[model samples]
Target chain A: MKRTDVTARLLPKLVKASASAEQFAPSNIALCKYWGKRDAELNLPINASLSVSLDYLGTHTRLIPIEGQVDEVWLNGQQLQPGARFSRKVSAFIDLFRRDQTLCFKVETRNNIPTAAGLASSASGFAALTLALNDALALDLPPEALSILARMGSGSACRSLFEGFVEWRMGQREDGLDSHGIPLDASWPGFCIGLVEVDAAEKAVDSRSGMQRTVETAHLYQSWPLQAAADMSKLQQAIQERDFSLLGQTAEQNALSMHATMIASWPPLLYWQPDSVAAMQKVWQLRAQGLELYFTMDAGPNLKLLFQRQDRDVVLQHFPNLETVEPFGSE
Target chain B: MKRTDVTARLLPKLVKASASAEQFAPSNIALCKYWGKRDAELNLPINASLSVSLDYLGTHTRLIPIEGQVDEVWLNGQQLQPGARFSRKVSAFIDLFRRDQTLCFKVETRNNIPTAAGLASSASGFAALTLALNDALALDLPPEALSILARMGSGSACRSLFEGFVEWRMGQREDGLDSHGIPLDASWPGFCIGLVEVDAAEKAVDSRSGMQRTVETAHLYQSWPLQAAADMSKLQQAIQERDFSLLGQTAEQNALSMHATMIASWPPLLYWQPDSVAAMQKVWQLRAQGLELYFTMDAGPNLKLLFQRQDRDVVLQHFPNLETVEPFGSE
Candidate 1:
């Protein structure tokens, strides 16, 4: 048995030694694109793409051990299903590395960010999970391996394995050995993201359903890989140079391109709500009035405002209806 | 004066022959792609796309001379302002062509397809006008030139000029001379389209508002040109090859892509009804269950199903909740 496993039986002694693991998993926004997969088993992207991890919004997860239980997981006070779409791959990870031992993982998850608003929920969730699992098991998987595992959960989650901007390198080799997430820089500073949460009450069509339908029916699906690969290269270079206009433009474009692939998929579908449009119109009207706000969207209605920290007040006036508008910065 | 023009002025002499010139304009579906100006002055596309001119779905517009009136215009039976969006565009065309004539354009417009449903109303309206103007003036611009005139009214409208499968070539020359609609195939016989009008309420955001906002704010607006161009090429190839799987997929993707661009646009928005998602989910589930239905969507909640005429029964079973459904074929 591993030393960590034995600590559970000898709980009082383990408490005296006092070990806890906490990690910050920031949200990610795709710049280049990674949509569609060449190898489902390996979770390989049809193309590479770049993404930026934000400083302000994400999940802060801490893992501690309890005395009696064999194995348990408490996510934000809710005992999560190891089978959850977000945490399924993590369960697979735990099963693989800690094969012989059992321990209760007391996870106190604090998600400061909104869930299912299409703002990289998986990225933060998985990033925090990576740190928690890494410390809890005392198993060391290189960042690349961790990313590959994360990719199995959600393709964008892989980007969260690192800080600042990163790229999920769509490896060329067919065997899928080189495919992994690599950090570009932790250098982005003075940037803050303001969110406009359009109160879109409509149910979102699961992306998984859309993606599957698209692959089966969308004639344009094959073209996405090449376009996504090209977009990734363009965005990587732009991010490396800290080109805000280019970064903002590329990220927005990539997101739309990804959504376009969905639109062009067979049975042509959408995830947009009426409120989403109203919010977008309000934003554009504000910009036309010269507020200088740049918008980015994921699959859902809420928008992320990428602007200089100082320009927030001017931008906030435009989105008076947002439920919560807060500052986001990276350490 | 030509015999027709002289006869038109003498209302009693103008029999049904001149009245035949006023066949109600049918609505058209933009097939290839229409976006950003190759020449904003001329309203040319960055790339060519294909659109089908519908027979059943359209608007009924008529012009009648009023005695002692130099000029008068009515839209949808309302004495709308000459500056109303549709009227203004129509007026501009008339002014450019018939500068010397004072004609009353009495338009009694009625939509067979649901209003504010994403099916292209203007595509049909302008298409009808192109034909109507030609008949009214005896200024027979060939189909290609008529398309250029229609292009000025709305980018997507130009595609409706051709019957069956048509492609709008986004000509490369800077003078904007080459962008015009051309038939991809002389016949679109095999395909039958069924429209499922879900929740027949007026759309909150019209395409004009949705598209304009998309252009101004959606970060995805920048990448639209490149993606749309590629889609046009692929769609043309798929149509020419007579591959239903390919055609269905590309069309579906294109429709979704347009919506994505809408969502990515500022004030993040959707024109979808709550029932739109439900209707689509039902279709997807039906398709998954081995139904032969392949569907596409415009901006509205209405769904366009493209399949052989024989597949109507299978498709109809899935849409029990729609407001109305009607099918059309080239025959």
Candidate 2:
């Protein structure tokens, strides 16, 4: 059946269930490391990372099914053709989860977060898809399991499956069935992080191609497993002790390590821009002058500054020239 | 006491000494991490480094006596002309080193090292001058103390004081008088390091400017002290164990960290060429397939791959496509 027909059929059902069902978008922060791909087909990581779902800075998506055999999925009202960039992955996602059901999805996605800005748009998109689909289908699977399925879509997506601090354990299981997201705790809300949106420009290479490059040519990727282990341990301890210093220091180095792997990767490309470096330098300079501001960058110029709420103004003043985006509502 | 008359007297001394001394030339490696001026008068590093002084690669120098009252130095037989691009620190080095001497010299030098290739030609040139001048003047400073003085000229030049492994210590005192070089060991044989030299063919930015850019803009430079400390410890362990895996792993990461700091440096400029990354990738690909081959790069396109002497052929066979240049005497 044509995608239009499928969407025509699925839209009615989606609207009835989610008259106001909103999708949530979250920006991604690379935790320990996710430099190489072990299974590109599955989008699995050689080493797992722990990340928090940024509830305030992500896309909110809602899916509505039409009456008849819904023909396709439409994102932001744009019908992607069969051979389109997102088609294979979206089709595979739908086919894997709703194989017996013929439903078209109207993915009304409002992205509060930037797309392809290296803040893990894929993570937010996939996690929102997982959440929206689960709500639409009424399939009551745990968030942990949903993330494992989402990992098949994008590796970092698994981390957004949890709230607060989370870890995607790099299970040694050969089938990769056991690798899934686990929350450090569903109850911790004091873990506050600020997003300093410097620039929201798209990157030259997306995460998929970037990871593939690292796996294919980064000789240093071989050492990532050991380093990730060390970093992960440090990250866990930092989170537990609420050590923002260690957290900021570790994240910056991990990001540097990831970029290092990229440079060492074949046909080496730099994911960083002059602005991105400038953003980081500005943060460092402010911090050096005794301002306790620690900044972490994902894959782009925008930075995630993790600090205590009391110090928000102190940190916020550092980026006074930059247009700031608050992570949570009302401060 | 004009420069010409000074050269007339000094050149004869240089000629007399050259006739009896064995000519030596050492290639320079830019530390990439340029610290503050040890003596703003004499450009120097806050720390020491291990540099591979390329024997066959260096400046051609002929010191000839000319009619002069004061000593004069010329590059490529040109009169010590004004506004010729060299390390700005050059002026201070000449003035201070010759402060006590009346020996006038007409020194001419032709360099093969790419000027401003972000590679330290000044380090090599001055180091070679240090050796050549010692031969000419018979000052007879010990190699260690000579290295200290050369370091006062350029940080990495001290690395040229020794043949094999070198460690540049970031001394505690700020005066930099204590800043000196120490050999890794007395008898460690020369490890096989393969070089791939690319002619940058353009006047590259000198290390001083590059470092000043780093100091002014690179917030990432703030992180280098910690990284250097970690690297120094790990490197010592690796050298002690003779563990190629650890050595390669640490060196590769250190080089990348150094580059990352550069990338993060503001007004960001890259010292790397496309070919530099390509060479890096080739090594990575070969290493991924279980080749114990390891690589490190200085400022230019040339990569120094530390391959086992026994497995050198095996490693070289993998990259039949890449143009490989053997070190001076390698058959």
Best model per lDDT: 1
Off by over 4 Å in 2: A1-25, A67-70, A77-79, A114-118, A186-192, A196-203, A321-331, B1-122, B137-331
What's the chain B TM-score of candidate 2? 0.77
If scored against the real structure, what TM-score would every candidate get?
0.61, 0.57
Candidate 1's C-alpha runs over 4 A off are: A1-24, A60-70, A80-89, A100-121, A136-154, A174-177, A198-212, A226-242, A267-269, A320-331, B1-25, B28-254, B257-331
lDDT of 2 at B65: 43
Best by TM-score: 1
**lDDT tens readout by residue for model 2, A189-210:** 3445666654433436676777
lDDT of 1 by residue, B1-331 (tens): 2212322332232222222246565566654446445555566665566666676667665655444333345666677676677667666655544544555555544557665455766776777776776676666557776776666666777776665666778887554446677776455455666667666444357665676677776545565666577677777776667676666666666666666666555455555555665666666666678665556676666777766655655565665433333223433
For model 1, report the TM-score of its A chain: 0.80
lDDT of 1 by residue, A24-56 (tens): 877777667666677665556777877667665
Which candidate leads in DockQ?
1
